[model samples]
Target: MSVLKGKKILLGISGGIAAYKTASLVRLFIKSGAEVKVVMTPASKDFITPLTLSTLSKNPVFSDFYQEEDENPIWNNHVDLALWADLFIIAPATANTLSKMANGNCDNLLLAVYLSAKCPVYFAPAMDLDMYKHPTTIANFHKLQLFGNQMIPAEKGELASGLSGEGRMAEPETILDFLEKDWQDKLPLKGKKILITAGPTYEAIDPVRFIGNHSSGKMGYAIANKAFEWGAQVILISGPTHLQVNYPEIEVHRVTTASEMLESCKDNFESVDIIIAAAAVADYKPKVVSEQKIKKSDLEIDIVLEKTTDILAYMGAHKKKQFLVGFALETENEFQNALQKIEKKNLDLIVLNSLNDTGSGFGTSTNKVTLITKSFEKEERPLQSKEAVAEDILNKIIQNYEV
Candidate 1:
C-alpha cells in the first residue's frame, strides 16, 4: 500500500493554469486511502470550480474565511484546518503565493492555514521558464526550505504559454509517488525485516471439531501494520482467523495447526532481523486423528493428547543474531513468570499481559501490558486499544534494536 494510506492531507491550490490539476491530485490522494481537505486561493476558483473539487474530495473546499449568509456569516477557523491535517501540500505554487509564504503573508485563507500549520509542508512550484529561473524565485525556494518546507521540484513539460522548460507542476501520479518515497525513506525502521506470528492455532480432533483459544489476532495484526508503516519488510505467520492484513507488502503465511505454524516460522526465521512470537499455539494436540466425524456414541470419551512443538524455544535454540520477542499471558505471578520465560526462551524482551487486569486478555480490543526486558526491567502501560499497545511494543524494540 502507499505510505499515504490513512493520512490526513491538506491540499493547497494557488492561482495558476496548473490549478485545474488539483482535481486529479485530490482523486489520487483519495484513491490511496488518504482523507483530503482542499484550501484554494480565491483566484484559484476561477480555474477550477469548488463544486468539482468538493465532489471529488467528498469534503467542502474552503476559499474564504467566512461565507455570507445574509448577515449571518459562517466562519471557517484557519487554526482548526491547520491542526486537522497530518501534512500539507501546495500544488501549482505560483510566484505570487511563494513570495507571500516566504514573507509570512496571510492575505488569504490558504496562507493563514499555512502560517498556523504545525505539520510538514510541501510545495510544487509551477510557472513559466523565465519566472522559474528568476533569482527572486530561487531565493524564495531557499528561504522556504530553510523554514523546513520541502519542495517537489517542478518538471520540464509543455506549459500554457506554448513554451516547455523546468517550470511545470509535477503530474499527479508523480506527486503521489514522490510523497510515498519521501515518507518511507525517513522512517526509522526502513530496510529492516520483521517476522510476526498471530492468532490461535487450531488442533483438529475430528472432521468437524478442533481445539482453539479466543485469540482474535488483533494485537499481532496491529503490530504487523505498524511495522510496515515504519518501513519494515514484514512476514506474518498467522493461524486461522478472520482478520486481514491491511498492506499488500506484508508476506503472509496462513496455517491452521500448531505444527504448520512452526514450519512456516522456521522457513522465514533465518531471513528476518526481528521475530515477535505472538501466536497462542496450542500446547497440546490430539495424538490420533479421525478421518471422518466422530459420532456421539459415547457421552464421555478419552482422547490421547501430546505436546505440540514449542516454536519459540526452537527459535531460541537456533538463534544467531536475531532479536527475539515473546508474549506471556498469565493469571498469576505475571512478572516473575514473564522473566523466567525470557531466560528460558532466550528472548530479548517479553510482553506480559494478565487476566487480572480489566479490558485485557483473549479477544478484547484493549490491552494492559507490562514490558519485561532481558534484565528484568518492567515498564507498565495502562489499558488502551490494541493498536496503541502494538505501537508501544514496536517502539520498545526499535529503541534498542540497531536497525
Candidate 2:
C-alpha cells in the first residue's frame, strides 16, 4: 500500500500548457488511495476543464470563493480548506501564480488557500524556457523555498514552444515518486531493512491434502506495509495465503512448508536491521510421505510425525545486532506464555493476542494485542484495525530500538 493512502491532498492548478497534465496527476493520486481536492486559478480553467478534473478527483473543483448558483451566497472557507489537507501541491505553477505566492498576494482562491495552509506545500513550476530562466522567476523560486515550500524542479524536455531546454512540468509518475520519497525522508525507519515472515505454512500430507492453519496473513501483511510506509526496505517471507501487497519497498518471497520459511529467513536475516516472525508455522509434519493420495478406506491409518525446526529459537541463538520480534497466539495464560516465549527465544519483543478476544485472532481485520519486551515491560492495546496495530507496533519498536 502507498504511504499516501488515506492522505488528504489539496491540488492547486495554475494556468499553463502544463495545466493539462494535472488531470493525469490527480488520477495518479486517486489511484494511490489519496483523497484529492482541486483548487484551480480562474485562468487554469481555460487550459483544463473543471469537469474533467472533478471526474478524476471525485471532488468538486473550487475556483471561486463563493457559489453564484445559490440565491443565498455560500462562502468557501479557505481556512477550512487549508486545514483539511495533509499536503498542498501546486502543479503547472505559472510565473504569475508563483510571483503572487512568493509575495503573499492572495488574488485567487487557490492563492488564498496557499497563504492560509499550515501543511507542507509543494510547487511544480512550468513555463517557456526563457521565462523560466528569468531572474524574477529564479528569485521567486528561492523565496518560496525560504518560506518552506518544496519545489519539484522542472524537467528537461521539449516545451510547447517547439524548443527543448527545460521548464517542462514533471510527468505524473515522477511527481508521485518525488512525493513518496519526500515522505520517506521524514520517517524514522528511513533506509532500514526489515525482515518479516507471514501467513501459515502448509505441510503436505499427500498430493491431495495438506496441514495448515486459519492464518489469513492480514496482520503480517499489514505490518510489512506499515514498515514500508515508514521507509523500511522490507523482505516479506510469506507462506500460502491469499493476501497481496503492492509497494515498491517490499520484496516478497513465497514459501509452503516450515522448512522453506526457515531457509528464506536465514538467508535474508544477515542483511536486515530487524526480524519479525509472524507466521503461524506448523509444529510438526508427517514423517512418512505417500507419493499418491491416501484413499479414504474403512481401516484407520496412522502417520508418523516429527517436530519441525524451531525458527525463532534458531534466530535468537544466532542473534547479532538485529532486533528480533516474535508473535504468540494463546488461548490461556496469554501474558505468561508470551513472556516465557520472549525469554526462551531471546526476543527483544513479543506481541501477544488471545483467541478469546472477539475482534482479534485469525481471519479478522481487527486485533487486540499486548506488547511485551524481554525486560517484562508490557503495554496492552484495545481492538483496532490491523493497519493501526501495525503502526503501534512499529512505534513501540522505534521507541525501544536505537535504529
Best by lDDT: 1
Give the Cα error of residue 258 in candidate 1, in Å: 1.7
TM-score of 2: 0.76
Q: Candidate 1 — which residues are off by over 4 angstroms? A: 70-73, 157-164, 287-304
For each candidate, what TM-score against the reference?
0.90, 0.76
lDDT of 1 at 238: 97
Give one digit per residue, the lDDT tens place, for model 2 in 1-403.
6678878999999999999999999999999899999999999999999999999999988999997888998898999999999999999899999999999899889999999999999999999899999999999999999999999999999999999988999998999999988886788898789999999998889998988899999999999988887779999999999899867658999999999999998899799999989899999999977899999999998989999999999999998989999999999999989988998999999999999999999999999999998899999999999999999899989888965
Q: What is the C-alpha lDDT of each candidate?
A: 0.93, 0.93
Clash-forming residue pairs, model 1: none
Error of 1 at 27 (Å): 1.9
